[model samples]
Target: MKITDMTSECIGKCLNYLSFDDLLRAAISNKKLNNAANLIYEQKYRSKRVEMHILSRLHSNYFMTENRFCFYSLRTSFQFLFCFGRQVNEIHISYIPRYVIPGENGVQNENNVELTHRAIDYANDYCAESLRTIKFTRIQDASRYMKRPFINLENLEFYDCNFTDLVEYNLLNALFPKVQKLVLKTINKNLDQPCTLKFIEGRFAHLKSLHIESNSYSKFHHADEYCILKGNLVTAFRLNPQLKELDLDLFVNCHVFQSNDVLLVINYLQNLDSLSLAIDDTFCSLLDSSVPPLMYFRNLKKFSLNMQLSTESRAIQFTSHQLDTFELHGVDRFTNYEYEFLEKHPTITKLILRGGHFERLNLSRIAAALPILEQLMIFDHFKLKIEEIVPHWSKFQSLKLLCFFHTKIVKDSDLKPLLINGWHGRFCNSPNKFQIILKR
Candidate 1:
């Protein structure tokens, strides 16, 4: 039958199976095919295309001309958004010039400021209506333009952005009144004071997840910085008591946070289901002290710690019965205290260990303790002889997923038994085959 004789349903079904590039090519073959391609493109292809178009312009100076729309500059990119922004669900603004020349006392230059203001205006006017997620990186004051509430925005992220003044902070709170997920990375070292959430109480009532990271590695060198960060965290938790997940990495190093401060924060986070703390202090003291028991985290299902605890504090016990996932880091050796702690969490089915010194005996101990563990991830910096450790696999009958990151395999033949079922980096042994992943 001739192509024109095919029904529209048949054409659409055939076009749906074609790859995007192939559909574009097929569109030019005939008028019938062109109409079919356009129908499919409008329904399934347009949104992703617009998102990529906007991202490409923001990340690079590359330009593309399509359908009489030219995206040669940042201005034209906004113009593209003005027409098709509804198709874009997420927006990322990588860098906004500070408009201040170095060595000029940080005074704002009128010319550059005008350019930034115009870009911000275009972004706000065109894209804010439909964006669900917005990320800003290296922006001097993104809150200046984002002061208005974004009705549709649910996820917001800021990396190396300045909120130096109360006005900026207030604007930020107003910008995403309905945000459910927020990620903040404080890396600007020039700020006189660290960002704090003391003024925004009851503002993030709907927020469910919060992640704060101190991208400034140098901040750990100063003791006072940790105090400031801890204060900020306390205030943040108080303001968002409804949060279900909290991840904090303030670049804290040994002896930064006292045992009391850590317990205080944990007490406030009873509602959290997942908690990741990267404070570089010893949890041993907290466990040994009269502070509330680990049972304070009643609802916590997943816990991650990247700290060093004294092996001397062997009396520590974790009684969070609901916890199913446990992650430990910065452990060079598996001491008796550590083993004792894991012995209490026999219900844990997922475990991740990083920067840990793991020997055959340690693996055997973990397998014996967490017999039902289904997923295991080990990120070791030191070289590991997988050949010598393969014999231990028999102990992990419940393990279904095993992953290794940044670990050097001493021998390639060690993976031969696991790879027998599949050569594509995935292997299954038999009735209870498990997947193994090794990353260098």
Candidate 2:
């Protein structure tokens, strides 16, 4: 069959898998393909308004908006949105700086406070009221501006934001009153400063998730500073009692990341369904073997704990009965207690171990404990006795993917247990249901 003669359903499916650039080229190839593309893309943004970034880049996954059509090159690919049927959305102001616009119409320049404001104005005057999310990147300080709220924005994210941008902007409950999720991230490796959380502008009582991942080498470790930061977090969590996930731990060595104190404070959030905490030896010191460290989170489902730098033999217990995923980093002899914990929760399907030296632990023991585990990832770890898993091969029929990243096996034959299993497949060398992937 000729490619152009295919039905729009098949053409739409084909376009769906194409890369953004390729999809554009295909959409412009012929009339039928363009119609199929319009039908497919329109369904995606039917209820939700089109995503228009006031700034430079929009992720490839985002649907093209009329604002994006301002760039001349894509004028052809996204021409479907400009068809005579839909009324064109107007650009907020006629006088935007030449540097802020992308492509030939504008010159690429540094993002500053003024440019950020222009982007805000674009959104404030945006004809579409369903614009639900906004991301501010490399913005220094937008605390001052037209001071209008994005009435419908539900998720607000700031990447490499100014140190006090959120604090100064204060997430004014009025500006983003309906925001359910707020994310703050800093890839600035050299941000060696201290900032407080206590002085944030407004108490957003309706938040469902708050993720802050700043790896700054914080200088606020004094006793008074610690007390204040801890109290501030507790109060924030209290207000956002519906918070489901709080992922403040990304960089293990970030001094600003309050480990021991955060571990103690987060216990008050009982409804948390997912949690990630990157702690060190100090947090381990607070763990009591008799009582699980995470006893308070009754509804917890997915939990990740990175022990970063701990050499001593410590035992930490988890009490979440609904846990579906567990990731542990910097494992030592203490992981024996983790195995004990998983033994009680056989429903866990994913287990990830990273940058750890397992002296007395066995891979098969983990499989033996959690028989239903489907995905197992081990990254940057010492050599493992994967051959030892042969005894528990029967228990792992439910397993699907086993990945070893930068972690070497003892020898070539060590993989025989996972591969070439006769019970799950026809041949010993070729298994059908499971896979063993090795990464360097």
Candidate 3:
């Protein structure tokens, strides 16, 4: 049975079983294998997602034949788009300064601005119809390219980008009127002059998700910055009234947000299915207050709360009958009342508890509360004997996966109960779903 005597289907099946690197190595062995490898490579990567970093110099022949390319540089990106525009679906452009000093005689260089304009013109001319998403990072003059229309672009993300003024910020709404998802992170270099979201005046009618975050941590910001951020947030809520999912991690300190402001924002969001809020102790106090009821978020199916400070009085209530996923982080302790809240929300099938202090009793309470939980992740500050907690495992009727990170197991017999109960255990492992991690 010589290799060449095998049928084409058998040979292909053999090649398909080989890893990509092995296939390339086999290609070097013979002409028949080389042809097969080329066919496989093209079939695998031709229409796959492509990312190209176009920083320094332009290479003429570099990505002329690739498809679905995500370009990072300005001039080279424009050239690549000019050549293979129809094949591209996503593009990322980051401005790389060529000068030794950023500013010349107190005025920033305009050459980068001009290059950006040219890139925008190229994108508009060549790939406007096929492009689906565009991301701009570390951009100085964002308004220059943002003023142009991207006909079919559905997603836009900005990271560490600068917007000089409110007018430039508003130009984003005008640039991609049909955009469905928008993500903005660290939008300003000067914390004193943070990009204001107050000007976002309901421009995106089709937007389904909006994510906004600041570069500065909540504890380090000044009073004035918090004031501006809060005002801008209120304005954002008013502008995008039809959003279905909102992720806000801007204000790290709860003191920055008043109880009424929190109520106003949550109440304004009518049909949201998912909400993620990262706040400090003061905001948690507001949730425990009577004014803004938890009923405001009763329609959410997925909810995440990342607390900044540890407090025993922390209370949060979710009356959402449809909520199937719940995540809580950075809280030190879960009181009996809080556990009771969880017991009421049996609809939650996926629960993630991170950075919380939990003993055997607390773990038992959690297992008893959410009997229908399918996926559970407990990371950091969880100290208990596995044998002591296993007695409560019978309560988890629907659990399929369990994970522990940086957890301490006090006794060797801690895992003996799990092995007896048909649960697999793994220690110091990597990337396996059915394994339970224990740190002795």
Candidate 4:
């Protein structure tokens, strides 16, 4: 039999036993073996091309044949990747100036402004042929570059990129007019105000997920000016009517706490299936609020909130029917009012609490509130009164995967009783149903 045929038969029979490295080693014996290996590893050809590119940088002496290396130069790895997928489903492209420096030797940078048209043509060709999800980040001028319409592209993401003005946003409305998922993350929040509003009206009319984050890594001269425009997430959501999930992180400035803009966001996204927020300390209204009457994401399952500034208290009231996983971080204290709100929810299956230093928490009351919580994580340093928490161990009957790390309570003998009671013969008895880990 031919070497390719023999290799294919062997792979079919012994794929579980032979690793990719083993196959490569076997194929390096002769020309017949090389051909057989190429056929077997064709799906990973781009990765192999990138490996050769990195090797060329590290060791100038190394070289590969045309078949081993992609047709484009090392600078156009993404370009080569674009051509490889015959049925393109998703295309995510991002540019960071540092990563796209001109080649030192004789190679040209394919990502330069002059060559971007060629890249767009490549993208257009693929999208025209098949359904595509196109996501771009750090494109210097997206509104001008992405002027043409795409027929088969369904989802679009623009992150930390530059755009000219509302005129450029008109171009986005023209392109991908049927986008079902829209995400925009930008540094110059003012530059694309109209573009953002237009997107909610044009493309995101039926958006399934809408995510927006501020590129606040850069310092601004007037720190407070961008707070209203940048931090007002409610304004962004109000523009969209059919959004199912929203993940927003906005700066908390003096004007953000109970602003009308925030009310607009809460009103629009009240029915989201998943929500994630990282906000500043100025917004204390986050602690206590009933679920919006118009919004009941009967399917809303995951929620995470990371408070950037230390707040005296925090609380959240939510329905337990669809909530299975929850995570809360960076709050100093959970007030009695907050605890009482959580006490009402008895069906959360997984929970995580991190960076908490409060010592006055009522452990028994907290445990009694959550009847179905299975996985619990109290990570990174948490100081608690062991005596107060240890006695309430029996309340958690369905408990599993308790991760309490970097805490003074880990060394206490009082915790041993709860540990033994919660985990003793339970894993074998429950069979991967329960586990507790203590890290200091």
Q: Evaluated with TM-score, which candidate comes out highest? A: 3
lDDT of 2 at 350: 90
CA lDDT, every prediction?
A: 0.63, 0.57, 0.65, 0.53
Task: Output the worst ten-in-a-row residue range by lDDT, candidate 1.
Answer: 49-58
Name the lDDT value of residue 222 in candidate 1.
71
Q: Which residue pairs collide in model 2, if any?
A: 420-428
Clashing pairs in 3: 54-73
Give a tens-digit lDDT track for model 3, residues 142-220.
6565435777789988787766664545556666778899888874535344555544545577888988777443433
> Model 2, 1-440: lDDT tens per residue?
87788988888888787764565566567778767765655554343333323333322223455334332222331342333113222221111223434344554543234444554454454322445666665554543443566666678776665646255535446667777888777777655444455434356766778887766534556756656655666667766667888886544553333435556555567788888777765555556456635544689888887776546645545557788898887765545567777787787899887767665456667777788788877655443444445565566667776665323323445554555543222112222212246311
Candidate 1 residue spans exceeding 4 A from truth: 1-46, 49-72, 96-114, 168-171, 187-193, 198-200, 215-232, 254-258, 265-267, 282-295, 308-319, 359-361, 387-391, 405-440
RMSD after CA superposition, every candidate: 9.1, 9.4, 9.4, 8.7
Which candidate number maximizes lDDT?
A: 3
Worst 10 residues of 2 by lDDT: 88-97
Model 1 C-alpha lDDT versus the unseen true structure? 0.63
lDDT by residue (1-440, candidate 4, tens digit) is: 65456665564344334555454465455555544454555544433322112112222322345434412233343333343333445555554333322345644333344344344455564444454566666565554455357665667787776544454436454566566676777666444332222333343444678776664423344545445344434444566656777777655443333323444455566567787766665554544446422223456678777766654554453443677777887777667855775575566778888766665666567677788778877654464444555666667677766665322323344346555643632111123222236322
Candidate 1's displacement at residue 15, Å, is 18
By summed lDDT, which 10 consecutive residues of candidate 4 come out lowest? 50-59
Separate clash counts for every candidate:
0, 1, 1, 1
TM-score of candidate 4 against the unseen true structure: 0.64
Candidate 2 stretches with Cα past 4 Å from truth are 1-113, 163-169, 192-194, 198-205, 221-226, 250-267, 288-294, 332-334, 357-361, 382-386, 405-435, 438-440
